[model samples]
Target chain A: MSVRVVVRTFSELCITVGAVIVLFVVYVLFWTGVKADTAMDDQIAQLEEQWAKGSASAGPGDPGSARGPGAAAPKAVAYEDGRPFAVMYIPRLGFTWNKPVLEGTRTKTLKKGLGHYASTARLGEPGNFAVAGHRRTYGDPFKDFPRLRPGDPVVLTDGTSWFTYRIDTRPYRTLPDDTAVVDPVPEKSGYTREGRYLTLTTCDPEWGHSHRLIVWAHLDETQPVEAGKPKALRR
Target chain B: MYGFIWRHLPGNTWIKALISLVLVLATVYVLFQYVFPWAEPLLPFNDVTVDNQ
Candidate 1:
């Protein structure tokens, strides 16, 4: 072959190979993302449905008969009872990690709730019921946590009973520490210390963990399973 | 602009088809291998925990 013709063929071959690689990368980055998103959405929706049904292990009982002002019903099952204490549904962000939320952060519990402080307080108590969760790993359970706003429901069910709370605040300015986030009552003057509350804590900045994100809510209402059931479980 | 056309030249039909095929295979492999596994845990996976272990 002539020198110029040989060089031209070699150049075209290089171009064709490079184009193939570029196209491959684009398909991996773009189309792969599209498919993953679709699959994740469908799976989340299905799991949310499963969460709506009353837990398989929950025995029939009147869950809220004992609940008075700041009174919690007898905890039917221990944190390790394998019964899900709460049905954490975040519709806006599409989260339905229905694993058992351990009441204490043991090695096993922390693995699920990220971390737990037993000394802090118990649920529906006067002190902090502090819990933590990983921001990125382990299913990224609370990755879209920042999307939570005031008035979102945080539902907690103790197998036989269910409790509902409304998201009260997302305070970024309270303090650099986690104490205020999990505090039982308002440290400030205007806030009342009488109502039952639920606080959710997770690592902040979405995938990045520069700080902690605290989502707090107050008990809106409660009922035993025989009385009023959550709309998700009604069907 | 001398180097622009040199970089932008279209390939022959056979080369173009080969390039597209490689792209499709690579995409399929990535979706099945890395992306699918990383995203699977987000879905329900038969509740295997340490207690079960």
Candidate 2:
């Protein structure tokens, strides 16, 4: 090819590549957020429908919550992989800020909503209930993660009960391999005993994952759904 | 690579440019709806878990 033609072709290729990169950015920032918001809404609707079905089939004396205080604790529902079982609300994020919590931390599972660490304890249990969410993309569920502070409450509901957990520490940054942050008693969480705790993790630096930001919380109180919103959730 | 496609168009320059623009828009749509979702799992930047295993 002539030198001028070759130069034109090279410049054209560069321009096309640049356009593609810009399109990719748009896909990540705008399109993915739009899609994730819809997915989260669908998940919440599905969970609500399931819960309604569950309650409709049971008698008045059922739901375990109607039982006396000295009775056995409510049985935890088995969380299915990739399925949403709970909705978490963080007032610190915003009054309208809520996200469905799905089982498993797989990449696909997280795209839809926050994912629970399958190895961690189930919600409201006497162990660390760990969860993960994206920091910058896929709706940026934890985009304001750094705003979390000690004493802030994270409320979650699993159809039958509302569990409120109060933050125990500010955001803790560590490498992704520091799996101990989700342990029954997280090493850095400053807890010396087992308890009903919540661990929230998201990627650090907003745009990168070289590190993680963690917020640890302990169960403050739990009440049956029929009791209205929990004290922490009250306006 | 793009030069071949531009040369093979069966129309004059203006028509070829219009067809190229349509093709580019179609490619972008395909990339967003299918290619990106498929390729996203293969990338690690979205990972937020401590135990990747």
Candidate 3:
């Protein structure tokens, strides 16, 4: 090819590459958020529909009876991986702020909603119920994670009851490998013994994951769904 | 690169332009639906948990 034609082809190739990169950015920043929001909505709808139908296998059984004196703790639901079984609302994050809590922390599961660390205690149990969420993408579910403060309430519903957890520590920054942050009695979490706890983790620095931000909370109360909304969630 | 395709698209000017638009959109759709999602795990931005070792 002539020198001019060669240069034209090279320039066109550069323009195409630049366009692809920009479009990839658009896909990551906007398109993924769109798809994730829809996925989260569908997850919530799935849980809601299941709740509305009152399926026989609903595992959190008879919250009212479970809480009575001499009654056993409610049975933990056997959640399938990547499936959402609860909806969480962080009042400190916002009154309208809510997200589905899926069963595992896999990328595909996190894309739909917050991922519950499978090893941790299930909701309202006697150990830490840890969850992870993206801070900048996949709808930025925990983008305001740093805004959490001591005494903030993180309420969750399993359609059978409301489990309200009270934050006991501010957002604590730690290395990503500090898996102890999700341990049954997490280090630096100020608990002397095993107890019902909640740990919310997200990427540190808002848009990067070089580190993690953790907020530890203790289960403060449990109210049956037949009762009205929890005090923290009362409008 | 576009010039080569524009010259060969069998149609009047407007029709060729429309066809080019359709082709570009189809390319984008493919990238979003399959290519970008397939490539997403290789990028580091999506990791939000300590479990990803």
RMSD (CA, Å), each prediction: 9.9, 2.5, 2.4
**Winner on lDDT (1 vs 2):** 2
Judge candidate 1 against the unseen true structure and give its global Cα lDDT, from 0 to 1: 0.51
User: In candidate 2, what are the lDDT values of residues B10-53, reduced to their tens digit?
Assistant: 78999999999999889988988898887766655586888874
Model 1 over residues A1-235: C-alpha lDDT tens digits?
6897778778977976686566555543454445434534544454445445634444444534566533655543344322224444444455343333544543234334334344445554555454455445444556667777886766655434566667777634333343555556745312476556666666555544345566667767666545666653342
Query: Which of the two, 1 or 3, has more lDDT?
Result: 3
Evaluate fnat for each of the predicted models and list the values in order.
0.00, 0.50, 0.53
Worst 10 residues of 3 chain A by lDDT: A68-77
**lDDT, candidate 2, residue A199?**
98
Judged by TM-score, which candidate is best? Answer: 3
Q: Per-candidate TM vs. native?
A: 0.51, 0.91, 0.93
Comparison by DockQ, 2 against 3, better one? 3
Per-residue CA lDDT of candidate 2, range A25-56, in tens?
78887988999999999999999999898778
Give the Å shift of residue B37 in candidate 2: 2.7
In lDDT terms, which candidate is top? 2
How high is the lDDT of residue A29 in model 1? 45
TM-score of chain B of each: 0.64, 0.74, 0.84
What DockQ, on C-alphas, does every prediction get? 0.07, 0.55, 0.66
